[model samples]
Target: MNLYQQAEYWLSAHKIDQLPEDEGIEVAFAGRSNAGKSSAINVITAQRSLARTSKTPGRTQQIIFFKLDESRRLVDLPGYGFAKVPLAVKQHWQKTLERYLQTRRSLRGLILMMDVRHPLTEFDQEMLNWCKLSNMPVHILLTKADKLSRGKGSAALEQVRSELSGEMSVQLFSALKRVGVDEARKRLNEWFQITG
Candidate 1:
């Protein structure tokens, strides 16, 4: 069986204190609402419903954890910038995300997702800046690449690649097409210290 096929629903944390113990390797997924974050997670785990993809944006309202093992996990951060969600709820999640990212000791890296057609929105730039300041490694997925033609997808990838700083990496990905899945998995394995 695939390694990530073992992923199980761990817990959901509305507050940083509600998260699991801080001893394990934790890699987080962050993105603007509707950026295909859930889809990417499901694809990465090779489980169709692992992250709860939705027709409606902002469905992920808390920090959801998937335990890959006793010492490794994947985190689904609350999607941001969904205008339909209440301001109070959005503010609460913002504070929680800020605190978690700043203080989580075991967090080794972030997998950031952006829609291929709309890479690097304002909120995405904010996240990139914050991660940079904290010296966290980030690998971005330009998701929904299947939405565009091959030439357009490559162009989009190059454009976003040019904008990133040295420590960050970006790639074209389509969960639907399984594009770049291996590349993304390689990065995740690096962060988790998984080796053959």
Candidate 2:
């Protein structure tokens, strides 16, 4: 069976304590607002509504969890770097994300989604910084690849890989055309050591 075919609902947490017991490995997905993180998750899971997509940027405000089989979980952290959001709310998300990254031991890795056109932003760097500081593994998925030409996509992929300095893997993706969907799924399963 496909690795993601066994996915099931886990739990969503508004706070760290509210998270379920750390019995399984976790792989978190995060990106800047409007970066297509939700779309990428939905594509990988083959479940259209597993992760809510929005035309509006920064719609996710919580650390949502979706279990992939019994040994692994997919985490959807709130998108960062949305300037128009209220200052209070942004600060809250920052604090919450910081705390989780600093303390969540069950976190096995991170799927740092980025727009293929605009690979990494300041907020993206901030998130990467946290991952670096904590020594967590990260894999970047360059979303919206279909929007770019074949040549452009290749160049963009190389640009991001070279510019970012971390122990993170990277891949180009397009949920619209389903490009790199299988590769991304395979990589995630390999990273988490998930097998049927």
Q: Point to the candidate with the largest lDDT.
A: 1
**TM-scores, all models, native as reference:** 0.97, 0.93
RMSD of each: 0.9, 1.6
- Model 1 segments more than 4 A misplaced: none
Please provide the root mean square deviation of candidate 2 (C-alpha atoms, Å): 1.6
TM-score of 1: 0.97
Per-residue error for 103 in candidate 2, Å, reads 0.6
Best by TM-score: 1
Q: What's the lDDT for all of these models?
A: 0.90, 0.84
On residues 85-189, what C-alpha lDDT tens digit does candidate 2 reach at each position? Answer: 999988888888888877777888889999999877787788777777878888899999989999999998998888666677788999899999887887787
Q: How many clashes show up per model?
A: 0, 0
How big is the positional error of residue 89 in model 1, measured in Å on the Cα after superposition?
0.5
